[model samples]
Target: MSIVNIIEDLNPWDKKLHGLFQRQSTEKLTLIFTTRENLDKNSRLRNELFQRYSVPEYIWAKVCLRLQGYFGAEDIFSEDGSTVESHVTWFHFEIKYPFRLPKNKDRAVAEHQPPTPAQKDGKKPAGYAWYKMGVVTSWKAPDQHTIIFFDAEDSPAVGVRNELKCNCENVKVEPALRNPYWAHQFLLGPILACYDEAVWNLRDHVKALEQGRREGKHTVTNSLDSNDRDLNESSTTFNALHEILRHALHKTEILGVAIQTLNSICARKKIFEEERYSAETVAKEETVQNMVITKRCARKIAVYLDFQLSIVRSLEARARANEARIRSEITLAFSTVAQLDSRVQAEIGHAARADSYTMVKIAAVTMLFLPPSFIAAIFSTTFFEFTPPEGEKVSKDFWVFWAVSIPLTIIVFVGLYPGNRGLSVRKHISSAAHHKATTVGPTVASPAAPAANMV
Candidate 1:
């Protein structure tokens, strides 16, 4: 019964709006009808039209506001009067999770590691989830009924409106039954269809997650066999699926609340009608018929609500299964990474041991040659007397000894350096084999005895 004007004030120069008006005088009755083309665009005229038609305040406000700020609305359904002469129910529904795409600037910022202080402060990122809002308001007056739908630009409410029109056309009934018939159809048809479409979309999303899980399992199996796979892609897909599932679950919760509200409204209407007509009996056959119709409509709505709940349960179960599968895949990927790490560590250990062995060999060669080299240097010094025998003088040609010692030192160094001796030996053997092969022609096998002796 509360009325609020949500439309902007009208311009003074706008013409008055024309609408249906009825007046009953003492001796005569008058009825005036207006066409759509004659309706004014001014807010005052629009308000007058609504008042004239007896549109409920709630429906008027919802439509005028375009359902804005209705997402978290409370006390959406209310009944008034002892006889339940009036009632209103408003419902909000969203078919999809509104996730914003990251802007180019956001993407560039995301590339930096150890995110900025602002990001670490728990602020929502650019691509975070947003909520779309849509509303359906239904009001039943003593002699008038109104159903107003306000939805976001991308919402399914438009589809529901089209479906409602189709349902209205399909029903055949007398004028007296027209309002009640359309009311019931509006409640059960388009409203139910909206929820049904949302549920179907959720089911499809869950199926996609299941498919991704299967693919992850295959990747895990192949990785176990070959020890080659990139877990990053699988990990990212799993996380994204988890996020989507969470959104889907939230949507289901909202739908459940909406369904419960609808069921409550129907139940209250049924009870009110039965109590209002309890004493009337045969005289109020029309009232009885209306009561019966209301009760049947309530029952049909209850059945649909139960079916929707079942679908929500199924979706939840599938989401849980996918969660478990993703967890197992992640565990397997970690194990594979661990195995690879262990292999790398083992290789490092082997290399370290080989290096230590080479260092030890070099130390041993140095120890074997150091004392002899020191002794030869000492004897070759001018201070040392080198007497070959009693009859021989000390040799004046010390250059001969220098030439021999220098060449011998070079030979020892070339032999003892780790890979030098083996390379030289292999080279000489290959040269000899090639020479033999050229002289004897390519048909004969090079002699193995010569190569072995040379080695």
Candidate 2:
């Protein structure tokens, strides 16, 4: 789409956009102010600002997009887009800060009724709250003036403006605001503040992770009662830490780019100052001094950012170490569980073999006695007479023998049926062995006992 159409669709300057930002974000901001004197009288600058200025249309489009909560082109973030024209030196860069949900009516609704499973699990309805805060600034050497735009106000911007208001009567502060160096340094405030906050968030996240790791260690150490549950929880913690670290690393990259952008601006400004005055046009001493001061301040800010970057790196290392520690603990828990399972399985195999041996012995005993018992039963039966004379082929009381044998056989078989009764016997035997092992001293078994057990 054309730039004008895009900007119109975005409606960046709409008051409703500010209201939307206020309603959704937890941060309270003061109104953004233009530092240039008589901005209303400068119709040319106003026209330039609204008509894409000397800067690219894409730059304006990006600023508009970020103002409306959408990220524009990635190329806009690069220092390569920064230019030093004959009449104007301008920068197109971005700043990012941590975002939070506002505790407003919307927050109340979210708490009262979560519509999604993720929200119920304490995650934000919107997956992430961080986005780019765009800044488009241009410095005109001819007029010794700057024109800047910020899509949103952060603490640093608000604080700077507030300081300007509070010290308006101070002669010292008034002169500083007029100096071109002040504008350059002023712009650095929000960038540094946002980076500092990003690093702080990283540090706090690392701290929380350390705490969680310690808790996980305690859980793993005392996991004898609930090994599976503890291990699963630890795994989940590790996964969460991994995701956080990934995000932390990404934020660090953004921070690094911010620092780079600052340095690039400083380098270009130095070049502009050096080349702006030629042998024909001598440079003013005050102007030269201001340029030097601006350079120093920028360097100091760079140093501060470098320190924060180091902290972020250290935090990343610490988080990785915690992740590794939790992973090892989980692995150890799994190994312990595996060993216990192996031991139990071995014991089960031994029990199966013992039961098979017992069954074989019982079968052998039944085989040895069954034939003799059968012959004795037949001879003792009243239905048969082994050595009887003439007509004693059968006894009249045979019916009595049949009735008694049938009923007794049914009762005996019923009582001997194998049900859960075997399980109970095995349990009793185990308990008795356990009790004996605990109560009595160990005693040597007879060699014949082993032989008898095998038999």
Lowest lDDT sum, 10 consecutive residues, model 1, at 24-33
Q: What C-alpha lDDT, on a 0 to 100 scale, does residue 53 get in candidate 1?
A: 35
Leading candidate by TM-score: 1
lDDT of 1 at 264: 53
Off by over 4 Å in 1: 1-82, 97-133, 141-144, 152-155, 171-297, 308-455
Candidate 1 structure, TM-score to reference: 0.47
Each candidate: what lDDT?
0.45, 0.44
Clashing pairs in 1: none
lDDT tens readout by residue for model 2, 63-168: 4444422221111122453333323334433333333323222222211121222466765554234434444433333223323444223333444334433332
Q: What tens-digit string does per-residue lDDT give for candidate 1 at 273-297? A: 4553466532443466776674565
Error of 2 at 284 (Å): 9.7
